[model samples]
Target: MPDSVGKPRRYRELTGLRLGTLVDRLRESLLFLPTVMLISALVLAEFFDHLDHRKIGPVIPERFQFAPEVVTVLLSTIAGAMITAAAVVFSLLLISLHLVSRQFSPRVLRGFWRDRFSHLLIGLLLSTFAFCVVALARVDVAQEFAPPYTVLFALVLTLGSVLGIVAYLDRVIRQQYIGNIMRRVLAESLYLIAGLPYGRHSGGQVGEPVTPPEPGSLGPSLVITAPFDGWVQQISRRGLMTAVPEGTVIRLETRVGAYLTKDTPLVTLWPPPPADQQHRIGQLVARSVVTAAARSMQHDIDFGIRQLNDLALRGLSDVNDPTTAAEAVARLGSLMRPLLMADLPARSVRDESGRVLLTPNDLDHAAYVRHAFDQINVYSADHPLVRETVTETIRMLQAASAGLPGREAARAELDRHLGTSRRHPLLTQAARADHFRSGDRRPRWRSATTRTG
Candidate 1:
């Protein structure tokens, strides 16, 4: 389903994403930064205009104050440079997007689309440019006005924008590497798991009771139909909990990743809704659900894993780049390493009063294991580099999964992989794992590992 895991910080950022309202989207738009900077610059100019009457320029430290002409020159130069930098940043972003799509997967762009750093960096550059323009205009209008404080502030912003662009470019460069991309995906998944209901360090971790609603126990089911068509990206558990009467059990029929159609069974309320409250409650419940044209990692942990798997599959395609495929396995290992000690897929949400507000279908440890490695395992056959990397990664995961729900499964998978390697024609005619253990060079599995490593 859509919203699987999201941290408190990310949840706040997500509210800025409006599925239906253009105004909310505008608030979060990159152009909003320049708009704010223009308005602020005008306001600050007026403030400095008033301060100019109070002899503020002479009061300002001599080091900070510039002559009126010098201030004009500084603002003009910074403004022009920022315009050029903004154009360059925009071009680089487009080029990188194309490169990643060609080399990786187009689906990976969903994660980047919502990247806060990218948005903020673009906003910063545009804001600096807008502020400089406004400041320079004000200075030009005033025949004798220096606006020393305004000039200093503009200078500071210009310097910050310069340094920020450099750092942002570095980040973009690092993201080009497959390993780095996987690491980012892993980090997002970790944050998502950490932010789930059961993720509170104060509460019990993985072993918490996770029983699904029994058929008979769930009272009369009232199907809530979808109000519109879209993917269920996020569920506002708090909104749903607050709207439904206390003690009402909500059985969600739709999950996070499902594509909804008009009249799709979204959820089924227990005991059904009364005549007067039915329409009103349905509307409220619908309000709490956020739908998007596409899936997002804001709540979808599996989507992040799916991205890595896509890369692995890409590497295994006719292109036959085993090294890239191996990178995906290594990254998955890095992602699941922390999962070895943590639980996932929160089954229920509770309010401050400790009432069960919502229960959505969730992933268990076994499901997580399968989802992370299964597809890659299927595609990695015949490619010894990808296969051995997977085996070694699973070995690392098996060691990490001790006392975890998926420990036995990981161990079994590890043994199966080791045992199967001997059967591979590339490995040997003897379907025994001891070939490599015995230091025989009948197969070049070691070389595959070396190249990928």
Candidate 2:
């Protein structure tokens, strides 16, 4: 039907395929079959060499026995095969890790050692089984064919080398290379997706009522304006007017793109109008009302910035002084919380029905407050203050939970805070509610707040 729906679906499918390709590449590299073959060959060669040196009879005399020159040739061939196998395995593992890490999370690959342990053990078992099968097969071929006593030595060397290589490759792949490559790929992909042409697709869904702009279409439609007539002043880009005009300018009370209300001025005739000029002023009185609202808003913003800067400076000054720093950090957290709360994305806190509204400013303020708390935590990781703040945040979350008429959310936030130790009271509160005693009404907590002087 609509191109809007079709385009997003197509993009998603392509993105999914790209991710799958990455995973396939990773699996091939990490689990190359050639490596296994080389490993088997190396074990076989080592077993024969050990048997010959120990004067132990071969398990397969006719097929495998050789003179000194032939033994030298065989050993060289086996060595080459083992090296080839290792190279193949390592190269594939590196490439796969690089590609998969780019498309997905590195955390997903965390348990590689544990997961691959069973496979390695199975490989060892199969190698032993194959040796036994060969021994049985060679029983009628020659009297010299018997069990190789050096099998134990060969087994150790083969398994040890494989393990060492795997460990080295795993470390190099996961730690040094994969994460950086993956991060870059993900960032670029996200940027590309965001840059794609998608027309006026509102994040808002259908059936929502859109609020239209206020009436009076053209130039300032109001008649009666501000009582104190001044020159035209600074106007916002969006047409919100501020009464901060220069003294020399004298023009109409209204400008193009300015909003008109019941109290907005109509004209500013040159020279002074006598008090007797109140004759036509009655006509101007009934039109509109536009007060100086922008000035007040600007003042509040400036004041807020100044206060934040001052608090930040104070905290910095007390950095070396633990006690003072703690107090300053706490204040900063309190101040920043409101600012962050005011800045959060409205959609994040809003309910599905969209009836519940949350202000972006509130969210933003909360985030800043959380950041301040994080700084505090970092500063006091080994100190008692961290525990104190953690406890305080829990208390705040508890209060919020109680206010909301549920302990579930508060408990979740507390648990999350315990794990992360990062500040963000609302997040902690929400996470706590979700995690702790999901349906339990009573506030159940084992840890008591340890007071810090």
Candidate 3:
């Protein structure tokens, strides 16, 4: 069960169990057993000393008696000390269990307990050996000996040694185990927090219908027109294509089914409508047709604006170098030029008196437009504008192509455009900016124009 803090309550409960088990196991282990037995022997010895009138053979010494007051004080002090040691030992055992659980896998808890048992046994053996040595040393003082006092002192020393060993081990284990566990938990939690995805889904969600573009939007809309002044394309799915005026040429780039941009060409034309069915067609169809075109164009304009903005903000010369003031200026130039040129209406130009004159005609305008486009390209290339604009455009095209069908040629065109501008001076500037400079060293040539000019 989760607690108020969201951590599993079972973990806390299991931790308590581990602590309880550790105390019980330690008491049964050799370390505690020897101490218990030694204290018991000391008490028995004191009891014998209290039997004042008891007589034994000549081999037994009479000087071994413990005074009643001394016995009472010794037993009381020893009992109090034993109780304190037990409490300390219990606390140590609990701490040791917690440390072991945190440092090692839960699977290793058994091995850890086994190791503790072994250490306890070793301590007990060492205590017993020391006691034997002390006993031997006192043999020479047999005439003045109080066996009960000797036994009690030995028990106290042995218990102190065992408790000291347990305390030291507990401290070391707690430090190592707690540190390791805390570090691991912290790292894992951070990774989970960073890696988990959290967001609202965009685009079409499950069971949601595609929203059609709004009417009257200034966008590229597709209008199917009569080709060759003939009747509409007789297809079973009449609704598949929208009807338009006869002789109306629908812009291929305009949104036929979806929103389009003005840059798209008119690919299909419609002939005059049949006189017999002309009266039946409603004016709303024509209006819808125009609305579709406008919406398509609007979408294209929006897309273009977004592309320009992104280019202006994100375009930088190098992946490593922070974007500089110069790089930003170039990116803004790239973004602005397209918008300016896009807003201008189509014009026809004629060479007259060594000057160009403009007129409005659909035909014979390609050469002039091409020449103008070439001039714009040359100006952009010569200027210290965003060099990465071309590269970004190509990347976007490539990305778009990956999703679009039958756009291999468009992708190829974009690739060619990028290839031409890849060696532009702005790109070179970006590259130079990215070049590593040691310490505070700066580049000798700060501007691309200096090299080109």
Candidate 4:
């Protein structure tokens, strides 16, 4: 009904069909790879049958020959096994998701759902069944076109599928351990951060004002509104640069993780478009900004932090596993340190004319530090090991804040956590220092730093 339906397609639709994001989605999907493998196997089975037609006499040697009823029974059984295997794999995976979501943070399920090995194994079972179907169809006693090798290939596929089941089961069992999930999430998170432009570990820009400039008070700008309701996920910088007219600077009001409904202002076009280009400008903007129903780790680093925090929170549950919670807090520290040390990712993109075409809003570091450490700190206060880990993590972060923009936020948080619960008899003589006197070590996580006396 609204202009949301308008289109002038470019590289790909905003439905996450971008080559990079698609590759990620493919890894999460259990159907694609195995389907491709099964199709190839089927084609090969048929081709191999035709090629060796002369070698095998009619009736396919008693050893390989499969009577119609036997072929029917075998194919049916294989198909049944595939369904059973799929059910088992899916059930185990679903249970894993439930356990982690309940025990850990619900957000971490993305990490578990994207298990590529699990996806591949399940796909293999289905594809193997497909191979059998093709192979069985080639067995025709009437025309004497029994494929001896095809039957053999089917038998081999069945064996591989069985082995796959074993491998899948082993992986599922091992992954049930919280430590494994955290490690995978942490490793992948670092890997994700390394690819980001603001990357500190990979040697990108550092020690500067990583914040995007505030909108100028003097400029009156044109506001671009959302045409539909959805979660803002990604923006194609190259497409924005290519689509916008020369000599215009586009400033985004919405960050990557915002949810928008119809008529919500998304971008502010400086030097608003000439009247002639106004109608199509909305379409161009829509083409570049991608939206979806759920948040993804595809573009949001905060999503990664949320996942790790989930793990840490679950450990702090009344189940009395302070060690697990501490482990998560430590990993969260490592993840946050890099971002705090790195510059904000570049937001500006340009065109052939050297005009700034777009500048998406850059998120604040203060929010990240809070999100990374806040909840765990509150939950860990009663648990000494978890509290020490938090203090140790804060101390580590405090040492890094020397010249960083939000360094004070870190210091203030550390100072605030000190006053949280000093009544503990464990406070030693050294703990009596001013730093430990106040419950400031917890610093108002997620809150702005207060320059208190």
Candidate 5:
């Protein structure tokens, strides 16, 4: 396949993934935003100091202008208060995170880490403290010059910081609600789904339709093994294609979200490259595959699914919160509904000329649906409310997948899960018979008392 064909679109996809990866990391980082705020605060201090030196902006009345000593004292007091307040604010946040991690699944901690609002709060508190410190140093008692504008700005920041603490508390409280947590996970999952090459709503295509070489005609193959152990995060198909010679056929042995141990077969190259070029090409292929210590929601839809499953499992644990488990089940159904409408890419990825360059084994809809709901089914078997919710969610998925192209297998998969749920030993004969129908409201509550097990 000619490099020119479909290369532009592929390049965009690769670049977008890199940019997305960087953004996700930044969002999760605690230092990036606060450091930015600190730098901006320093620049602002200097700018205000310049303004105060020339006395150009916002004329200050003689009566309002304070002596350099009073300004020094004011700045010191505000700086000390801000540092102490920062401590209290972050301590409260740490307490909240601990409680959240304990109550919900620790896997959900990523959500809290990516919270821009909390990051902004931290930046504000630190920036206020830094600004005061810089402004305090600028006080020139020898020249009898007090930066009135800078002091005024410090007071404003102090007031804003106090209000921000209140807002942060309110946000933390709302975020702790199980319903909101599910919604956040659902929203993030949908976002990832939207970026996928599959589905009618997606903007880009994985590759042109193409047929692979017949197995009998395919000759000897070279295998590339991973050098380290990590979870496969991203595979840059375009990068791989560009690194290989023309007409090279490559098949990925692992897909995103798969954990790879050292020496794991990473990829297979059919009609292997020349002896001298093999090592170089292998290095490029390995470079194209990104691995990380932990799973991320960037491209791995299953990670989000896993998070919801973890939440459900936590509910089914000693927490004994069936309502939370029910909420999680409903959200999982919502996550699957979009995939039903999406047309997933074929295993074969082709060039612009319809030549197959890579064959990636992506998780099909059935696998995702099973990954999303199966565990909730197993763990929540005894909880009537959770059981009813899981049944209803499977029904919802069935309805969404009905009549959609390329979704027959997924629909069958849902039917199988639904059937398995109905056969739970705790369910009555009547409940099993009426399983396909809407859950009976009275039995859901009545089942609590009529436990067969």
Candidate 6:
């Protein structure tokens, strides 16, 4: 059940999730920033033309002034040059992105897409082209008049574009480095983790308690099926609680990351609502749920973890780069620390009155840990460098999570992977296991049961 004191926090988290998803979509799109800049450039051009036409600005010195013919030629040249430069810069960026995807994991492409610097560079270049094009239309060679300030502004943009491209290239080169890529992914993942609706627990109930009906007391159940096939992206828990009538019990048939086909069971309502209210309630429930053609990190923790794991696997592949894989593993461990210490919310959430309102099938802490590292464990089994890194990462986590509810379960999972004997002596409750040594070259054990006896 959702914590009584945590209801407000949960609402804020969901609101943040919606905002984050919207921002992410805008950031990922190629047109959003450029389009905004283009419009700004056009507006600036018109403003300058107005200033020159009304003779509002200070008079320019004769040396700085240009004939209408000269101004038109310059604007045309700048327009053509900006467009050509933009084409070249982005073309090179695409090649770099392609190589980075091939070298690392394709998932990292999202990181590149979210890069603001690259966006700004392209926006500036395109906007410069747009400004010059608009300014050219304001030139009046027949009347022997040109917008002087506007022409000067176009020149300034041309210079800025040249300098921007150089800096953008440097950024692209540095971005290809594996360390930068991992750090970028880690930062984004951490942000997503902080806003997640888990970990806060209070003793008191938040809503009024409603008594549940006895087993089989429900006359008939209402099964809500998926309207279309797609991934379960975001489910608004608060929305679900608000839409349903008091005392209604909701069972979520799918989770945030699960994919559903058309007509698949999406939700089940127990002790179904009155005949007249069923359809309206169903529509509300559907509105609260969101689906997409692809997975995203907006509310899916697993998706972010998957990106890190993919990087680790790339390191373990024919590349034979254990250092890179170890780095990825270390970050994964850091990411898992907070999740281990916090109190995960219950699958069954109750109203203020303690009546169950929402039942969601979210993955538990142990399951999340396994999902983050299971694949790396398989491939890193033979590489001691990577294997020892995993060992130390889990050891740190086990020690950090001491006395927490999730500790024992995580410890048991560690034992399953590295064997009981491999559990570092310091982190174990039992007396030191002499067979294990931190510095041992080959720490391999035949099985968890392998013993000196």
| lDDT against the true structure, each candidate | 0.66, 0.36, 0.35, 0.65, 0.77, 0.73
Regions of candidate 3 where Cα sits further than 4 Å from its true position? 1-273, 279-282, 290-298, 301-379, 382-385, 392-405, 420-453
Error of 5 at 408 (Å): 2.0
Please name the candidate that would achieve the greatest lDDT relative to the true structure. Answer: 5
In model 6, the worst 10-residue window by lDDT is: 426-435
TM-score comparison, 1 vs 6, better candidate: 6
Reference-based TM-score, model 1: 0.73
Error of 1 at 420 (Å): 7.7
Candidate 2, 8-52: lDDT as tens digits? 443444344345434434433424433584467457755665664
List the candidate 1 regions with Cα displacement exceeding 4 Å. Answer: 1-28, 57-78, 110-121, 140-147, 164-167, 200-220, 237-249, 345-360, 402-453
After the best TM-score superposition of candidate 3, give how far the Cα of residue 244 lies from its true spot, in angstroms: 8.3
In order of appearance, the predictions have TM-scores of: 0.73, 0.23, 0.22, 0.77, 0.87, 0.83
Candidate 5 or 2, higher lDDT: 5
**Candidate 5: which stretches are off by over 4 Å?**
1-16, 62-64, 142-145, 198-206, 211-217, 353-360, 420-453
If ranked by lDDT, best first, what sequence of candidates would result?
5, 6, 1, 4, 2, 3
**In model 6, which regions exceed 4 Å deviation?**
1-20, 61-63, 142-145, 196-220, 353-355, 421-453
Name the regions of candidate 4 deviating beyond 4 angstroms. Answer: 1-17, 52-79, 140-146, 198-217, 318-320, 346-361, 401-453
**Backbone clashes in model 1:** 5
Instruction: Give the per-residue lDDT digits (tens) of candidate 4, residues 279-351.
Output: 6777777766767777776667777788788777777776667888888888888887777776555555443
Writing each residue's lDDT as its tens digit, candidate 6 over 1-453 gives 223454565556556656756776898888899899999999999899888888896897676578889988888888888889989988987898799888898878877877888888889999999998888888887765577888888888888888998898898889989888888777766765665444221112234434444436755788888777888777776656656566667777877777878887878877677788877767766755678787776667777788889999999999888899999999888788876776555666677633465444677777887887677866775466777787788778778777776467776775555545454322221112422557863534333223311
Task: Using TM-score as the measure, name the better of candidate 2 and candidate 6.
Answer: 6
Q: Model 5 lDDT vs. the true structure? A: 0.77
Could you say which candidate leads in TM-score?
Answer: 5
Q: Rank the candidate models, highest TM-score first.
A: 5, 6, 4, 1, 2, 3
Q: How many pairs of residues collide in each model?
A: 5, 49, 26, 21, 2, 7
lDDT of 5 by residue, 186-251 (tens): 887898788666532232354675766664577888888998899987777766776566776778
lDDT of candidate model 6 versus the reference: 0.73
Quick one: RMSD of model 4?
7.4
Candidate 2 accuracy as TM-score = 0.23
